[model samples]
Structures are given as C-alpha cells and as structure tokens.
Target: MKLLVVLVSFLAACKAQNPEPCTSPALLSGQLTLATQNEQLWAFARYLYDALGQRIRLQEMGFYQNKSFTYDALLLYREGVMYEINNQESTCKKRALRADFHPMAVPRNASLMGQAVLGSSSGPGQGVLVNTWTGHLPDNARYLVTVTEFGCIPISTSYRTQPFGWMVTSFFNNVIGISDPNQLNPPGFCQDALHEEPIDFFSLFHMMK
Candidate 1:
C-alpha cells in the first residue's frame, strides 16, 4: 500500500512539472517593442489583437537609418488584406496578405525549455510563473518565446529569419480586452489606397529600412 501511494505522488509531481499547453485570450491590447540585431531598425507600437476576428492593428513608430517615421497598419487576415497608412505622408497602401492568423499559443511541436518565477516566490502576489518554449515556423524561421504560465500572456519572443537575421519583440502593458473596438478599423484615408501586389509581411521590415 505504501509503494502505491508513493507511485501516485511521483506521477502527480511529474504532471505539475510538465503542464499542458495553454492558449492566450482572443482579444488583447498591449505595447510592443521590436529590434533587429543585424539591422539598424527599432520599432515601438501600440497594438490591438483580435484573434477571433482574425485582425490586428498596430500604430507604430519606427527608426531606421537615423530616420524616424510613424505608420498604422491594419491586417485583416480573414480577408487576406493589409493596409499600411503612413501618418507622416498622409498616404495609404493596400496589399494582399496571404498569411493566416496565428494565435498566440504554444505550437504542438514546441519543446519546453523550462519554467521560472520572475519574482520572489515566497512573496505574496509578487512572483509570476513563466514558461519558455522553442519552435520553428513553417517558413524555416526559428523562434523562442516566453509566456506567463497562468494566462499564456506573451512576454517576449526572439525569432531568426533568413533575410533579416535575428529580431526580438517584447510585449508589455497588456490587458485582456481591446480598449476600443473601432481601433481595428482602417483610417478613412485608406479607403482610396490602391491595392498593390501581394508580398510577404516580413518584407515590410525591409521597406522600412
């Protein structure tokens, strides 16, 4: 009887160490900062993500080659369209986005790197448990991401792409819901934007430079 009890306890401990994967909330708003290690590019943005609606909007300021510019991008994945509005130039460009909406969830093939507490574990309401995972995208890009263990809120992600080298993106000041539902809509000026040829989303980074 004592051996059986020990075996059950050991199984419970192992389960706790390797919890099941979790999906993040469908709607969220946050601040995002992205930087490239191999390029002279840095960007900051306020983002609204609606996974259920298959849309995302980013009001971004980017610095490249000592020039700073601001733009707003609305990606409508369900419609396979993306609108890029240049706040400085008062111009808008529309292009086809052939990518599908990728939820902020751990991929089925991801390998868990480990788990750690961000603050003092003994302190009440102080520490946050986080899980780290590494995986590869279908396009052959590799990524390492860390998310909160409870809600699966993303903390940071580092990805390496063939053309751009390595880039790191951090998410913070996030809340569970979109503050303004209309924030996802493209500006009125985009109504007249001409549709351009389809291009990979990563190509925008190259254009920014």
Candidate 2:
C-alpha cells in the first residue's frame, strides 16, 4: 500500500510540474487556423496580418513621433499592396487591401499582437487597433494591449507537406481603446518585451478582432 501511494504521488507531482499548454497571450502570436465555417474570423486574421506587414515601417515612425512615418491615408482593404509595393502614387493617409481569404498555412516562429482588433463590418472602417510596441514601438511608452481567453494546440495528425506545430488562437480586441500607458499602473508579462529596444519589427504582426 505504501509503494502504491508513493507511485501515485510521483505521478501527480510530474503532472503538476508539466502544466497544460498556454491558453491566453501565448496563443496570440504564431501560426493560426480556423474552420471554413469560421470565415469571418479567417478574413479578419488575414487582413490584420497584411496590414501589419504593409504598415510596419509607418508604425516605427510613430515611435519617434514621426508622422511622416505615417504612410498615406490609403485604406487597407483595397489598395494597400499596390501602395506598399510601389510608393509613388499613394495619396491618402491610410491604405486598405483585400484580406487573404484562402486556407493559410503559416510556419513556426510567427505570432500576432494581442491588442490588434477587427473593426465592425457594419460600421465604417474606424477603430482597428495595432500594437506597434511588440517589436517596433517602444518600452518607456505604455503601448501594450490585452488579449483574453487565447489558446493553442498542436495537431497530432495532418497530411500537409510543410512542417507545422501549434495552432494558437486568442480573443483580442483593438488596442485603440485601451487606457494610456500612464494609466495601466503596473506593467504585465506582455509589457516586459516593451523596454527591450532595438527590436526586430519584422517578427511582429497584427491579430484579427
């Protein structure tokens, strides 16, 4: 009976030390997949990624208060790619591009920000939030955003040709609505990355609302 009790205790201890996979911000950055049934979510995610990739330079400009870093006011749902590829004819303050609406297969080491939010489809494209601080923005500035109830899991079986690991998902909202940096009181785990500068902006991306 004593041997049995020790064995059970050992198993319990191992399980406790190994904890379950992360389910919140950990799921925010990295490859993501959604069912075809979840088309709205998929569309939102693609547009967010495209916007991040396209406007990354502009985001960096904001760090130094360089509005010139602000690209033309071209909306991103339509003509963003053209403007990004060839910056000659862009006139607006923002750019828009079509969301990549196909089955996406992103690789490892890729992740999106928590504060990135999707605007209401019914309303004018108004408050899409993007956290520039993840890699490009800054530390002293309170630019960190929050994502709730995020989760991730690796598929045990798949026939895809490329290698894949985990499918991380998060319930994130727009960063535009958050309180100013001075208001957040204490910093968070996500905010820890902020102070570490000379960041690589390429690794950063936006998340769909």
Candidate 3:
C-alpha cells in the first residue's frame, strides 16, 4: 500500500539524518559523574587509557566523607597495579592488583567511619557501594558505609566488547533516604533497586560503535 511505502521511506530518511559516530577510538579519556541533590553521595571520576589498555590512571573525588581517591594503575590480562589513597592522611602505596574481589568492596573496620563490617556485591561498575551491617560497629565511626561509587574500564582495541573499551560500572550508587545507615538495605544488585528512593546511577563514557 502507499501508506506502507511512505512509512518505509520516512524510516529510511530518519536513519540517514543521524548516524552513530566512531566510538571505538585508539584511546579514551573522559569524566564520570555520580551525584544526587541531597549530596548524600557525589563523586567525579576521570580516566585515561589506550587501545591496548596496558596503562591507565584514574582520579576520583567524594568516596568517603567528601574524601578523594586516586588510582595510578594499569589494566591488562586481568592484572595491573593497584594504587589508592583513601584520604589526605593516607599516603599512596603501590601494590599488586587484586581483581579477585569487586573493587568497591571496602575493607572491614575501615577507620574512615563506622567501626562496622561490609558485605559484598556482584554489581556492575566501581561506582558507590554501600552494603553495611549495622549492629556491630567497632569503635567510633560515622556512616555505616552501605553506599559507594566505583568504575572499571577495560580498554583495548582487541577487546571483544565495544568502543575499544568498556565501563563495566561507572559512578553506580544505591542510597536510600532513611533515618539511619542501617535503615538502608538495598537489593542484591544495584540495578535491581533502580526504581527505589535515592536512585542508583551509572554513566556511559563513550558511545559504542
């Protein structure tokens, strides 16, 4: 029918009007933003890496009590350097990379806040991770730490995924507005709780080809 032919032509015209760009570049450098109006959780992650992904470094702000953390590391063959500065007082140290656990999983009894314990999540991205256990906080600490944001970009031209790299999870945070940190108990995965309060977020660094 004439109407069907017109619809096809219109669709083809729209496709020709705007096409996707070359997202798969030899190297990529971009910013990651994770924020909310209440300021309960906010962070900026900037990263730079090449096609092979042999070397990479990322700078971040607002992971803990408005603290900043940095990673001057590498990512290749499931291995690389791991350098992190928790706060101004904590000096930077080079250590072997440990991809065994999710990067967002914080150490127990972390001095920052909350003498409390943390649970693990198989979520995407290194955005914000906050799965806190409320009852037993070691000493004197502020937040129970059931909320966090992190990112892991696997950049390589040969990388099977796309855009020569991937941001598995970027600036992902799942924080619920509650009177107490313990009151915030999210689902198993951040994406599972997307419809809830204090919505969780994940950002796309570059468009995929």
Candidate that would win on TM-score: 1
Per-residue lDDT of 91 in model 3: 42
Candidate 1: the clashing residue pairs are none
Point out the higher-scoring one by TM-score: 1 or 3. Answer: 1
Residues 1-209, model 1: lDDT tens digits: 99999999999999887855678899999999999887677999999999999899988889976788676788999988999877667788999997778988888788889999988799889999999999888888889989998889999999987665798999999999997998688777788989998867787776664
Which tens-of-lDDT digit does each residue in 54-126 have in candidate 2? Answer: 2211111121111122221112222223122213532222123444321112222223343344455356666
Instruction: Please say which candidate is ahead in TM-score: 2 or 3.
Output: 3
Task: Estimate, for each residue in 1-209, the C-alpha lDDT of model 3 and write its tens digit.
Answer: 99999999999999774322112233446655544433334456665544443344455554433444443322332343343332344344434443331232333543333222234335554333322222222332222223222222221110012222222224323221212322112112322212212111121111000
TM-score per candidate, in order?
0.89, 0.23, 0.30
Top-down lDDT ranking:
1, 3, 2
For each candidate, the alpha-carbon lDDT, in order, equals: 0.86, 0.26, 0.34
Off by over 4 Å in 3: 1-8, 15-26, 36-41, 66-78, 84-92, 98-209
- What is the descending TM-score order? 1, 3, 2
Model 3 worst lDDT run, 10 consecutive residues: 200-209
Decoy 3 TM-score against native = 0.30
- Report the CA-based lDDT of candidate 2 relative to the real structure: 0.26
